[model samples]
Target: MSFWRAVLAIIFPPLSVLGKGCGSFFIVFLLWICGWVPGVIAALVILNNPER
Candidate 1:
């Protein structure tokens, strides 16, 4: 993940993973609604995905 992306993921998780895909965005957004920590974790995982 880029430095800014990592920072963004911690600050506002969903936006960090926006370009990852609709599915990824939806997943992170939902997790965000549930709780910010889960959302941050999800965003980091999606953003750091190896296949990207």
Candidate 2:
């Protein structure tokens, strides 16, 4: 991920991974709705995991 993306992930988790595809966006969005911290954590994990 780029510097701006990292920044976006921190500020708004769901918007940051939009380019990653619909599934990722949906998962992150759900996590975000559940809780702020979990969503950020999920976004970071998903962003880091290339295999996903």
Candidate 3:
């Protein structure tokens, strides 16, 4: 993942994954609702995946 994206993921997880797809956005959004840490973690994991 790019440095900016990782920063974005840290600040706003769901927004960072906006381009990934609807499902990913929703997943991150839900995770964000449950807890900020989970959302950030999920966004980073998703962003780090080479096979988007």
Candidate 4:
């Protein structure tokens, strides 16, 4: 659900901070600027990925 996704975006930024093919640091930075939800989602997605 979006609620949980948003929550994940807050807890872990590096995973959910989706950007224009940017690196982790950039993604994290963007996520921080955007808000907590984006960060958590980025972090979660990154963590969820098996290939990392």
Residue pairs clashing, model 1: none
TM-score of 3: 0.97
TM-score of each model, in listed order: 0.94, 0.88, 0.97, 0.51
Error of 2 at 41 (Å): 0.6
Over 4 Å off in model 3, which ranges?
none
Top-lDDT structure, candidate number: 3
Cα lDDT of model 2 by residue, 1-52, tens digit: 7888888888999999898899999999999999988889989888888785
Higher-lDDT candidate among 3 and 4?
A: 3
Question: In terms of TM-score, how similar is model 1 to the real structure?
Answer: 0.94
lDDT of all predictions? 0.93, 0.90, 0.98, 0.59
Query: Which digits, one per residue and each the tens of the lDDT, describe model 3 over residues 1-52?
Result: 8999999999999999999999999999999999999999999999999999
Task: Let me know the TM-score candidate 4 reaches against the reference structure.
Answer: 0.51
Off by over 4 Å in 2: none
CA RMSD of all predictions = 0.7, 1.1, 0.4, 6.7
- Candidate 3: what lDDT? 0.98
The lowest-lDDT stretch of 10 consecutive residues in candidate 3 is 1-10
lDDT of 1: 0.93
Candidate 2, pairs of clashing residues: none
Worst 10 residues of 1 by lDDT: 43-52
